[model samples]
Each structure stands twice: as C-alpha cells, then as structure tokens.
Target: MINGSGFEWQESVSQLINVLQRSDFAASFLNSIKAISDFDSAVIMAYGVGPTPKILHDQLDDEYKDAFYDRYLKGAFILSPLYQSYKNNANGFFHINDAAPEGFFDSEYHQKYYCYSGLIDQVFYLKQFGAGVAIVVSLARTRKLPPFSRLEKMALKSIESIIISLVAKNWEKLANDEYKFCDYLNKAFENFGRSVLSKREKDAVNCMLRGSSSKSAAREMGISTETERSYRKTIYNKLNVCSHSEIYHLFFKSLEFADRGEDCDPLSLLWHSAKISH
Candidate 1:
C-alpha cells in the first residue's frame, strides 16, 4: 500500500533499489527511509570512514543544520550519552528521546539548548561492518514522535542490511584510495613547514599559471598584499611545494584518483550538485 505518500510499498522498494544503484550513497540511505517514514527532516552521520565524522547528508533548516555540524566537529555529540547508548545496543534501532538507559538521554546540555532545535526525538541504528568499531546511523525529527511502527522498523532494518553489504565490499578500497591521495598531497607539500612565502609568492605562482600577477590576483580577491602574503605562507606550509611549478604539477598532471569508490566518481558529483542546487 502506498498510503498518502504517492508511491506504493512495492514501488518504494524499487525506488530504494534504484537509489542504491545510483552513485551517491547518501541518496540511497535517504531514499530507503523515505520509503517508509514520514518526517520533516533527516540526517546521517558517518564515522570511521572519513578524515572526520560528519553529517554525510541531511535535509534540515540550513542555519540549524550548520550549527549541528559545528557541534559535531566540536565532538559534543560524539561524546554524548545518547551515542554511548547507541553503541551499547547494536543492530536494533531505538527512540532517542524515549525511555533510554539511565544517564543516556539525561544530558543537561541537550535539554538546555538542542531540545529546542527540533531534534527532540530520533531513531538510531548501529552497524559495524567494515570499520570494526560501531558506526551509528540516525534518523531524527525535530518534533516529538511515537515509536516507529512495525512496518517502519522493518524498513529501517532492510536499509541497514543494504548498507552493510555495500560498505563491506568497497570500504577497504575506498580507505586505501583516500590514503593514497593524502600521501601524494603530503609529498607534494613537504617544503611549506620551513619558510613561509609572502603574498608575492602566491600571486607569483597563481598568476604565472593563469596569466595573473600578485597585484591582479590581490585585486581580484580583494585583499591587501600583506594578507595575500599570509595566505601564500599558509598554502606553502600546507602544500610543502615551494615553487609555483611544483604546486602546478601536484594539482594538474600528477594528480591521481584510483581505487576510488563509486560514490567518488563524476556521476556522484553530478548527483550531489543537483541535490545542492535544488
């Protein structure tokens, strides 16, 4: 049965399959949930797979969403009792604001502020497939809600199963590819830690490649020479490449993207672009 959401359950499951086959992994996750749940917002936090654990994809108020992201970066949620509860009870899902374990949803911090952020109730599923340690996938609503219906619970389980299968197969290669890119980046930028370059340095490099000069680049970017010099120093330090030519080589022809997951490809880029645009 389709209910009022426009698609029947069978068509919704088919939609999930289509989403899984698409290049953007996040889209698949969200589509799976929309197949069964009705909520004003959704967020997915991915951990142990990236340089940082962050909201992989979300549909929420932009400013509030940014605040949540900032909070995640600060590791507040990572250390929360709610997260701990999710870790303890793996695989099965739960309601975050419900009668969770003692000291779990009893966070003084959450009640004081985040409760008003429309993040009151949530359903979470924990899985530990590729990374070994558990990774939590949460679907939340700003408003309070009843527990997931039996059908909704089953749908969440199905989505988790699909995620487990896909990640176990591709995660190691994805990790390796990220490592390779980071290694190459480090090798290319090895010299920047020593001497900081001036604005003249950056302008010299950027302009040389693109027919821009320090003055022109500064004018275009609307910054003072001194500020430009500061950027140059930071770029030089981070990239470790002293000369413009080295940075050019590092970015241009020498760059490589192999062993990349399907989600890292051009089609994924297009999908994300489309999502962000809309």
Candidate 2:
C-alpha cells in the first residue's frame, strides 16, 4: 500500500506542479490530497484582518454551498473552533473531532449547519502568511464516506510541509483590499444582549451558544451551579426566549437584522422589527 501510494503521490505532485500560478492550482491541489484520502468537497479561502474571508478557490457541490458560503460566512464561522484556532494564530492541519469545542458535536451550531450540510467530517490545512492574511483549505467528507483512517492521517502529516510551502508561495501576494471589511456580524454575536443582559448574563449566553451546560458554564465562569441556572433564567426572561434551543435559534434569527458596521446587540433590532411588523 505504501509503495502504491508513493507512486500516486508522485503523480499527483506532478499534476499540481503543472498548474502552479494558474487559476486551476487550488483545484489541482485538492485533487493532490486525494492521493492520501478521499474528500467530498473542498474550499480554499484567504482570511485576514477583515469582516469576511476571501474564497480563493472551491469545488463545493451545489448541496453544501448554502451552508458553507452563505450561512457560515454570514456569522456562523465565529463559533467554529477551526476559525477560532486561526484567530489565535495556530496553523496547520486540524480535523473536526480534534478542533471543535466541548460538546460541539451535540451543539445546535453543529446540528444546524454541519449536519444540515450533510458533512460528517472536515479537515483543514491552514497557514498564516504576510501580516494578518492566512490561507486555509477545508476538505470535507459527507456521510457517504467514513472518517480519515490512521494511515491517511499519517500520510497527510508527513507531507504537510511540502503542501503548505507550495500553497504559501502560490498565494503570497494576495491583495489586502480583497479581504478587509467591518466585522459587525461577529461583534453582534460577541456583544449580543449586552444592553439587556448583565455581565454575568452575557457570560451565560456565550456559554449556551457554545453548547455548555449550566454546571459546565458555571465552572468555566467561576460561579456556582445555582448561580448559572439563575443567570440562564434571567437571560431567557430578558430575551423572551423559553429554552436552550430557543436561545440558539434567536442568536441567528437576530443576525438577519444585524448592524453590518456597528457593535450593538442585534436582538434589539429583532425586537424592533417584530414590533413594526405587528
């Protein structure tokens, strides 16, 4: 198997080299990775100190584009552990199970988008370069295939340096103007309900969004279990939400009316829209 894979990898690299500095490079690069393991779709994005990420290349099927492009780009990427890792300056290969938050598989964020998109597993190849710009390739697997095997992981790791070096060299001069924007949607989530929820209540909301239970949230916040429960209740009352699920739903619903260039609680706008509609 190793010798067979070696031959395949050599061939893939030859094909990739042929496309260097061309529009087809990213697509060819993804195909090169196929020598190690299979993936359903792939997207190469350039992220920087900006409100949005620039899609350098992609071969996403029609089914997953809405979830990956529209929703995730709009605001959902803020909750992605992969995106958070990039923000924190950690780069290289990251698999979904290794990178997601605690209880992330069970979180509403995962269910609503990851599962909704039919993606069962995802792996990213991220490399930061040139100030705030980072290039990341997300390779996803749908339910049609099992997760990457141990041997495949080893193969990917062994060649990580070669791949990342080529990627950085190919995209080193990506334009900054193509990537900058106001991060208003992310700020809306970070400061959500700030006008109505107290500091403690805000913490509780953050915990809830990340799929933390009351006890777990309290432990992380250095508060008692009962205090966390009380905070949750207050949040529900202030936001007029009834349960954990409602809180998660409202988070995105409020985003539909987010102030695109301002830091403010998006919930207020949601309320105003509701009132006006009536």
Candidate 3:
C-alpha cells in the first residue's frame, strides 16, 4: 500500500526511527535529517549548556563545513536576527533568503558565515532532545534551491514529532538503566570499573551517587581530588546537567520515577489537572 513519493517518505521515516533507536547517536541523527530533507548538508546544533552551540554532526563537504565551523566561531552568523530569534524560542523555523529580512541574510556576517559557506536555503528545527535541554537540528542546501514545498514541510513536521517522542523514550530507558545500575553498585562493592562502567566513568560516579562527598569520593576511589573532579565533570558534561539536583530532576525524577507508575508521576498529575482545568 505504498505509492511513489509518499512511499519514499514513508521509508525515510522508518529509516529515521531505526537510526534514532539504535545507531551512533550523532552520526545517525545527522544522516536521518539529511535523508528526510534531501539536502546537501545537515548539522545538529546544541546550545546554552555547552561553551558554544556545537556542530555535533555535519554531513557537508568538509572544506565547506570546516570553514563554516571556523567562521561560526568567529561571531559570523550568531548575531543574525534569524539566529537570535531561533535561539530565543524552542521551535522550528524554515526559510529561503527571500523569506528572510531584506538585509538580514545579506549582512556581512551572513555572507561570510552562511552565504559563502554554500547554504542557500535553510531549515532550523529546535527542541529538547538527547541529554541536552536545547538541541537544534539545522538542515541546509548549499546550492540555490527552492525551499521545502508544502508537502515537504508537512513531512518534516510529522518526523519532528516522531523525533521528540523517540528521544523522550530513550532518555527514559537511560534513566531507568542508571537507577538499576546504581542499585547494583550500592550492594555489591565489587569493582564496577571494567565493563559497562568503563565507558561511563562509573567508579567515581557510583561513589558520589552512593552518598560520598566529592572529597571522600576521591579518597575512596584512590584518585587525586583533581582527577575525581575531572571525572565528576565528565559525568555532568556527558549528561548535559549541572548540579546533582538537576541530575536528580532529569534522570531520577522525570525519567526514573515516571516509569514507576502513573500515580507517582508529577507530570501525569499535571496532565490530568490540565484536562480538568478546561
């Protein structure tokens, strides 16, 4: 029951879901976006939490992408109104140069960073995903091309919803997995440093999560205070969280407790409350 272009899009969605479910986190995401949009280049940008909005993945001509990243670091397009407004809101924005302001895309900033970089038409989609609070997926065509047509935009919107749901589900699993792993660590006291923990910087994290203060955690793990601090830093970094409190909020409260039962979830209560509010 599949047609021509419609079937192509359906296949794209299925492939994207698979990638999001099981693939190298960054590479797969970029590949999916590129496939869906039929664009020459795509990059996923994460903002706010990091030192800068990082180009986590880009499938562009390397000479183009590297120069774009380099100029991007030099305050090129970050100041554009289009970029600013997109950063201001957590939503998707799509446009051609004609659709943007008269001088906006023509500014010196735009020309050097975006125009010359081979990005003629652009689509910027921002939302929460993965471990980051704010993630932006930007797809662009370096060559001059028409903006996405009405049907294409609809396809993008549909896929965007699927992407959000998938991210939420995976984060839920990670949270549950972390909680279970922590339980095992607490009771065993056996070295968790080798296998799964090795990839996750587990020993130091387990020590702290099991109620060791940073100083005590360092001593118990037999690493320098600085090394312990560095390990803790990586934990927070990879998790896209700040304090232990935020960690609890994201992984424990939202993901972990939500899985416990509907009766125990604050979001569930809020959902029911909203239903009654109207």
Best by lDDT: 2
Q: Per-residue lDDT of 1-278 in model 2, one digit per residue for the tens?
A: 12247789889888787788898888788888887778887888877757777788887879778888888887787777767667778778877777766667788888787787788778888888856678888888787778777776777778888888888878877735555566666677788888898988998898788776677778889999999998988888998878888988888888876764476678888887899999
Model 3 lDDT on a 0 to 1 scale: 0.51
Looking at candidate 1, the ten consecutive residues that score lowest on lDDT are 185-194
**What lDDT tens digits, residue by residue, belong to model 3 across residues 114-181?**
66687666765656533333555666766655556666666666677666554454333432322222
When superposed on Cα atoms, how far off is each prediction in RMSD? Answer: 17.4, 2.7, 20.2
Model 2 weakest 10-residue run by lDDT? 175-184
lDDT (C-alpha) at residue 182 in model 1 = 27
Q: Clashing residue pairs in candidate 2, if any? A: none
Off by over 4 Å in 1: 1-7, 85-89, 97-100, 133-135, 144-278
List, residue by residue over 1-278, the lDDT tens digit for candidate 1: 11234355455556545555345756565554565675556665545444345355667776466656655443334334444453344554555544243333333335433564567556765555433234555666654455456676556555565555544333324333332222222222222222334444544343333323445556656777666556766675665668544544443322132123322332233334557989
Q: In model 1, what lDDT does residue 137 have?
A: 57
Ranking by TM-score: 2, 3, 1
